[model samples]
Target: MKKIIPYIFLISVVSCQYFEKEVPSEQELMEKQMKEINWKEVDEYPSVADCEAISDETLRKQCFFEFLASTIQQKLSVDTLSVLYPELDTIEVRVTINPDASMQFEPQFPKDTVAYDTIKIDSILRVKLVDFPKVNPAIKRGIPVKTQFVLPVIIKTEK
Candidate 1:
């Protein structure tokens, strides 16, 4: 009975720690994980079929950007942009790629820009930039994520 009493007391003291310490709630655990994740950058950039097999991250990104730039240049060349707006040699476009492998584009114009040129340029872009090849969406932590970025496209590749 004496030995049993000591064992019981030792067990009671040790068990007290279990009650004092917290097992984190689901929300708390989730919040901690979210904080630990890198939100500023994606694990993989969006890619086309041409860039899919590239193993090096930097090269893969370069290939994708180059492909997009050349495609844009080719498409825009068919438009009468030079005849309509000869002075406008370059434009910045905001491109958004969704997780579902869809895309959207909008021209980024300066605040002081004239409405007439903006309207014309926008229409030209909409008409010219269509029927692009499918793009695999960016990935973050093994999950597809939406990404948006501004690209400076040279309106006149000859220049």
Candidate 2:
């Protein structure tokens, strides 16, 4: 019994390293999780009440943007933009929707654009875009997130 006890203790001591696992540090675990996440992709896009019924992800995003662009076009059509700048056909608007449900709109002009009065166009957009219904912010990993998107608004006027 005494001879067997020493052999058992020797075997247990030599085999203990094989049974142990290297624990990853917190930083390593965080880096691995970040690598698994895609920064450019979102689980859900920011949406208005009208777009909530869409089931498909791609279609929901499309509907949201289209509804916003159409609403913008309609609202701006009645304003003095076309009359003030008849040559301006379309403007790209960058809309930022915050997680807190606040919003902002900024007109995007081309680098070569020097003809239109930017201040007037920006003021017009600000005034006309205030009436949009409350928007549900985008979702990432089930948490509400801010989203920014650009929509092209065409100017149409009938003579």
Compare the candidates by TM-score and give the number of the best one: 2
The parts of candidate 1 lying over 4 Å away from their true place are 1-21, 157-159
Candidate 1's residue-wise lDDT over 55-131, tens digit each? 99999999998888889878998778876777878888888999999888799998998744787788888888889
Model 2, residue 65: displacement in angstroms? 0.7
Candidate 2 Cα deviation (angstroms), residue 43: 1.4
Give the runs in model 2 whose Cα sits over 4 Å from its true position: 1-13
Model 1 — which ten-residue stretch has the worst lDDT?
Answer: 113-122
List, residue by residue over 83-108, the lDDT tens digit for candidate 2.
99998889999999999989999999
